[model samples]
Target: MKKYDLLIKNGVVVTTTDMYACDVAVKDGKIAAMELNMDEAEAEKVCDVNGKLVLPGALDVHTHLQMPFGGTVSADSYLSGTRAAACGGVTTIFDYPVQHAGETILGLVNSKKEILEQDACVDYAMHCCITNLNDGEILEEMEQAVAEGITSFKCFLVYKKEGMMVDDATLARLLIRAKELGAMINVHAENPDLIDLNIEKFLKEGKTSAWYHYLSRPEFVEAEADKRAVHWAKHLDAPLYIVHMADKEGLEACIEAKRQGAEVYVETCPQYLEFTCDVYKREDGRNFVCSPPIKGQESQDALWQAIKAGLIDTVATDHCPFQSYEKDWGKDDFTKIPNGCAGVENLYPYMLDAANTGKISFQRVVALCATTPAKIFGCDNKGSLVVGKDADIVIYDKDKDFTITLDSMHSDYDHTIWEGKQLHGYPVQTYLRGQLVYDNGEFVGKPGMGQYIKRSPKK
Candidate 1:
């Protein structure tokens, strides 16, 4: 006897952890009911899912929206970035708040505030980066950020000379703060000393090719840092989240740490699963360069295997884009090329290709790409399709086939690493809180309508 705003009937609704066949009822921008049979007369709008997968909208927890890096800016602004994300079925994305050298934590927060307030098109959150933990005053400001709902902070163990990396002692201190503040420490784990040594050696040998970028920071470097970060997190009893776990070795460290009672979680990006070091070593390699560069084919197989075995926890795009000419910014020196690849529009479909190939289940795909990231990042109300939650949803067409073209994509970057790859399944329509945001490869929503999400205190 209750009226609803919209009804999606007779569909298999997939959540992060479970699946059900039900008719979802929405009213006033939230899920109002989910029943086996709901009369269409009770709703103002109706969608016939026709047995397509009805999934909770995805949440991309790692993205570099309108970011400045390597003396240039990432091509995707919040307007372009989240619009691309919405087209890919992601409704929420958490971008990093990068602190430049000498900037206060609060100042960095305000700077990002200006960008998000003016641009974002879908829901968003942020992870604060700690560039200078040595300063006690700045260190104390981290707790204030946590209280303000920035529940995670990022620390780099590499790029020490670049002022972004945190030394071991500094990392330990921040981990302790994270523990006490009940916030998550997201680590960019690559050993700075080893990478520096390798880069210097490579430069001396005149090896400035794109492949040398991967050779300079191989699996062992990431493995060593992975182990060290896990070691430090365990020592401080801190909650740690490892970003961009690229290889089996990295996942092994995470699994071992988790088994030993360390609060460590691993997130792998689409590039690691879909592309390999071979791609970065090719004539087209420059387009694929990202820090913690893509590893060997064996490592690629291991990542998918680990996902199946439950060793990996989540999949994010790490959506950082620079233009084609900018992609060669590292051509003069491999290290100078900015890290990140464009995939905000491809994360879900690329993963769907994996599922279609029998590498993972649809449920697992949703878990890695959407549900887990939301729960882990504390976006409780938006990740799953349950009654009383937000009506952020994606209607996926299993039979839709599309070849990826930069012409059809939305990133400001003119090229993508996935430029010619074909995708089997894609989102036919994406809705945020019952409103259509993306349809037929276009964004219908206006900028600044998306709200800034603040995480609740961690349990």
Candidate 2:
């Protein structure tokens, strides 16, 4: 019998902290060995990855698969969405399973279990959201959820009228409890008073254009909320993660809190890194409308510098998608526009291209797109390309380059915000646990093939 099932030879191996040349051997769905040289006859199958880059499959920790909001469902289901994720070299995703008042959090988990079991094309988990904090039964459910291996909980402070917002008292209570339970709180921080006040003011002035949407949600809306959330978490000494942060003030506040010994991690997205508020000037500006609206180039530059300086912990997509025309809900009223954009499929190539262009080192790209997400969310076996880790890997050509277009993409939407943008490289093959699932833009993995991953591995 052969010593290994598969061997990848002569690739430049990259992890979050280091890069080197190695021939990786795989056996029984795990990385079996890494060495500078291995005998070709030791493996039953061998692929020479000379001149290619071998990196870990990415993890998109924030996505809304088949989510319903603003009178329409999000554009992608779990299968279709993870298919896009697979094609883009992402092998694991942590989607949101929202819980409302009077509902059991695990019940939501049970309901989503079948969808993931029957339709997911990649490994998956969820961060339970407390949509109705006053439901009295939820605090107990939160503890049970942690027992079952979901290590993070999500909360919003900006959707008061929609019943998704939690008051400061409730947020503090949740944070304090999460600290005791060993789970982290992921927050959507925006001062609803500021957001609502600006919206009301704009409506009264008849400034209801798409551009006004960005105007109504200025940087202070996110800044004040982040500062407040940090303050409370600092007081309690609890772990908190601020999601999709786009403002310079918010970043600075997080850095200051960390310096004072608060346990906080912050995430920002590609839309914030690449585009600015100028996107609102286009005829289709409504498509770019999302909560905590994109900032100007000045903020983007500051965010990049912070990321380079190691002030940020993770980078995620917040991949909530809607169709191009879905913005029509707010044609006459900017307040009704569904705030989201599609991004999962673009994470890999966009970051790789950033490395190709000298924007970031290749190792930092791995840290942001794959390694740190697993560490933050408790997927011990899923992030790095190392011995004993799950064999989730990507073989990519550094020379391949292309411009993104709707015709070449895989999301369920008819249009993309990244359409016509250029990508410096693309993945040639993607593997999950030593199994080939995507190649040349085709998905070969079946639904139900992806196993549920609890933050702590089941014994």
Candidate 3:
């Protein structure tokens, strides 16, 4: 009888820590072995991926699909988002779950899983999001969520008007308690005072265009909040992960704290690295509208250096996209336009383009997109190209050239923030737990085929 379910040979197996020219065998949905050569006769199916780059499938640690915000829902549903993720070389995602006022975090977790159970097309997990820190019941539920293996919880430091911001005292308590409960805390680090004040300043002079969105949330707003969050983490001696950091100042805070021996990790999106605030000048610029709006060329250069120097840990898509018409809602006022970009679908290729352009090493791509997220989030079986990990892999055509466009994408959203961007290298095949789910331009995975993954505590 054949011992292995599938074999992939003649590919360069790459990971954050190691690379080997080897053949890998997958059996029962887990990597069984990898070596320079494995007998093809022992496998039921074999793919000769000669001259290809085999990488651990990318894992996006942040995404918002079909989420309600600013009077409309994000365009991608859970299934559509995961499907898009698969086509983009992503195998797993840590999506954010919204907790309504006074709703139990555990209830939100169960309900989200129920929603994913019907529609998800790839493996899914989530970070518990706290909207009301004052509710004692919700506060207790945070501990229960950690026990249930949703080990990371996020609360925004801004969005006061939307009722999502947690006060400084509340943040301190959450940080202190999370450290005790063996959970990690993530924050949307933007100073509300700075942003709100700037918004008033802009509107006072009749500056209501999308460009003002960038003006209101200046780099100082991010820097100030990042320093505050880091000190809170330092005070509790707890681990912190700040999401979608937009400027150099905030990142420097993380670097300083790390030098002081704190466990401070920061993530930045490709939007920040690849584009500038100048994008808002375009006619359809509202499609690119997002929180901590993409900064300038100087910030972009600093961020790229931070990533290359290993100061930045993971690269995630704060992927909350709206349709073209939906974005028009904010045409009268940029604030009314929902804050997000369609990016989970382009996350891998953007970074892959960086590698091809010599801005980052190929190994750094695996680290930023896969291994580090799995490690920091405690997905023990999801990030490495080694024995016993889940066989989530991407077969990439390293030299293939393609242009990114809506016609070529799988996202439910009609417009892409990255429309018309040209790139080299793209994933040709994606495997999830030993099953081929996406193959160039086609999605073969079925709804409900994805399973909910419970994380082990890394605290």
Candidate 4:
């Protein structure tokens, strides 16, 4: 019998803490062994990844695939989104399953699981969003959800008009309850009152361009809500995860919260790290419209510094995209635009490009994009190239140069915010549990290959 199902040889293996040249062997969909040198004759298949970087496949923990928002659904279904994710070297995604007024947490998760089982091309977990507290009935279901491996719940502090926003009392209740349930509370921190006021002011004054999207949710608007959430988390002694953190003030608030011994995790997306509000000044500004609109250059620089300092826990692409025509709805009024942009296909490449260009170390990229997310979100079998872990790996050619374009992407979206950008490094091959899902610029995986991951409780 073959000692291993596959062997990956002559590659520089990178993990969160170390990098070294080694050969990896996989069996039964998990990493079987790693040696400085391994005999190829023992494996059924041998892939020589000479001179490439062997790293853990990234985890995008903040994605909104097939989500309904702003009267239209996100462009990518689970199949398309996970395929895009695979091509970008992501093997697992923590998608949001939002709970509406008439649904239970488990119901939403079950429904999403059914869809994922049919369409998901990569492994996945879900973070349940509680839009309707349901008079504490939903809170009761959280324990069951956590027991079912959905260990994190999301709440929005903004979007009051959309019926997604949770009041301060609700946020506090969730924090306290999540702590007791050994689950984590993820929040979209933006002050809705201030944002509404700004929007009202902008519309009344005829300032309705895409730039107003940025203007309406200025830095303080996000910072205030961030600080408030931190305050509650600290007061209640609960863990709080701030998603899509975008501004300098908000980052500072999180930093201070950490200093005060609050259990706070900060996540920022690629859009905030790469582009600033200047993109909103372009003719296609509406395409850049997303909640917590891209901030100024100062905020962008601060996010990088935070990542360098290890203040930022994880970098996820809030991979939610709408068609360009959907964005055009808000062409004259920013409020009419559907929020979010295409990003799952760009997350790993963009981060790897930063590492290859010396903006950050390769080790840091692995930590931010893979290890930390898995650790924080309770995916025990993921996040590393360690022996015995799932062999979710990416073989990257650091010397390969790729340009961002819609044609090269696998998402359902027709346009990309990253269009025309150049990436210094790209993933040449991706493996999900010892199986090649993406190879040489094409998605070779099929739908329904992905298995649902039942995550552990937050530690």
Which should have the higher TM-score, number 3 or number 4? Answer: 4
The local distance difference test score of each candidate is: 0.85, 0.87, 0.88, 0.93
TM-score of decoy 1:
0.96
Ranking by TM-score: 4, 3, 2, 1
> TM per model?
0.96, 0.97, 0.98, 0.99
Error of 2 at 351 (Å): 1.1
lDDT of 1 by residue, 132-163 (tens): 85467767887788777888989988877777
10 residues in a row with least lDDT, candidate 3: 133-142
1 or 2, greater by lDDT: 2
Ranking of all candidate structures by their lDDT, best first? 4, 3, 2, 1
The count of residue-pair clashes in candidate 1 stands at: 1
* lDDT (C-alpha) at residue 49 in model 3: 96
Who wins the lDDT comparison? 4
Q: For residues 1-459, what per-residue lDDT tens digits would candidate 3 score against the true structure?
A: 799999999999887766679998999999998987788999999999996989998999999987988888999999899999999989998889877686778887888899899988889889988877645676676677777779998979999988889898888878887888878899999999888898888888888889889888978888899999998999889999999988888888899999999999999998998789998878877878999899988888889888999989999999899888889988878877889998897999889888878988889999999999999998888988889999999998888898989999998888887878998998899999999999987998898878888888874
The digit string of per-residue lDDT tens for model 4 on 1-459 reads 999999999999998778899999999999999997899999999999987999999999999999999999999999999999999999999899788898999988898899999999999999998888888898888888899999999999988998999999999999999999889999999999999899999999999999999999989999999999999999999999999999999899899989888899999999999899999999999999998899999999999999999999999999999999999999999999999998998998999999999999999999999999999989999999989899999999999999989999999998999999999989999999999999999999989999999999865
Model 2 misplaced regions, further than 4 Å: 457-459
Better of 1 and 3 by lDDT: 3
